[model samples]
Target: MHKALRLTALAGLFMAAIAQAATPIDVYRDPNCGCCKSWIKYLEANGFSVNDHVEPNMSALKQRLGVAPRLASCHTAVIGGQFVEGHVPVAQIRDLEKHPELAGIAVPGMPAGSPGMQTGQVHQAYQVIGLTRDGADRVLASYPADSSL
Candidate 1:
């Protein structure tokens, strides 16, 4: 009976490792960017494993990843073959994961109370925009979704 319990525990651990290994997201940012590090911490807090890629030419990298200048952010991410631009929330990122049909999502500019750029009581209502590889964009999720803040 004890051996069976031990095996079950081992199995659970193995499965957990597999789960962690599966959802690796690549993050590209400037090496000098502090906000980018904060965003990475945010993703990690939401159970994502980030592969950091520091690129000196962030503008060129964003262009290469198909993130439109209008929807650009300080950092960019690639997850499950989709581009995620800017300081997008973890919930929105999770939603994007389920919708592979969409090319990507973006938080546009750095809002005052965004995950990475947080300050006390500073709430700038921002919109998370959905995008296609061909440059079309639409509002995907609005921050403070209810606008009660």
Candidate 2:
């Protein structure tokens, strides 16, 4: 009975490792960008296995990924065949699976309190903009300022 229990625990651990390995996302950022590193750490903590790529010309990469200048941020991530720009929250990132109409999502500028951009308890109002397949932009989610100051 004890042997069977040990085998079950081992199988569970093995499956857990495979699950972790399966949630891979590719992140592109400048090597000197500290916030980008923080964001990578945040993603890993949230169960994403990040493949960090340091790019010399971020503008070119963004352009290739169809990220418009107005929707630009410090870093870009590719997951679920969609581009994720800036410090978007994990919830929205995960929600990308449900929205096949969207080409990608962006947080625009790095707003304080967003995932990797957290500043203590302080957070700023921000919107997660989704770029549609037809090239129109829409608000997928909005985060209001933290009022519990």
Top-TM-score structure, candidate number: 2
Model 2 misplacement above 4 A: 1-12, 15-22
Model 1 lDDT, residue 81, Cα: 82
- lDDT of model number 2: 0.93
Q: In terms of lDDT, which candidate is strongest?
A: 2
Residues 72-148 of candidate 1 have per-residue lDDT tens digits of 88999998888999899988888887776678999988887888887556778899899975667888887773255
What's the CA RMSD of model 2 in angstroms?
2.4
- Listed in order, each prediction's TM-score against the native is 0.82, 0.88
lDDT of 2 at 70: 96
TM-score of 2: 0.88
In model 1, state the lDDT of residue 45: 78
All models, RMSD in angstroms = 3.1, 2.4
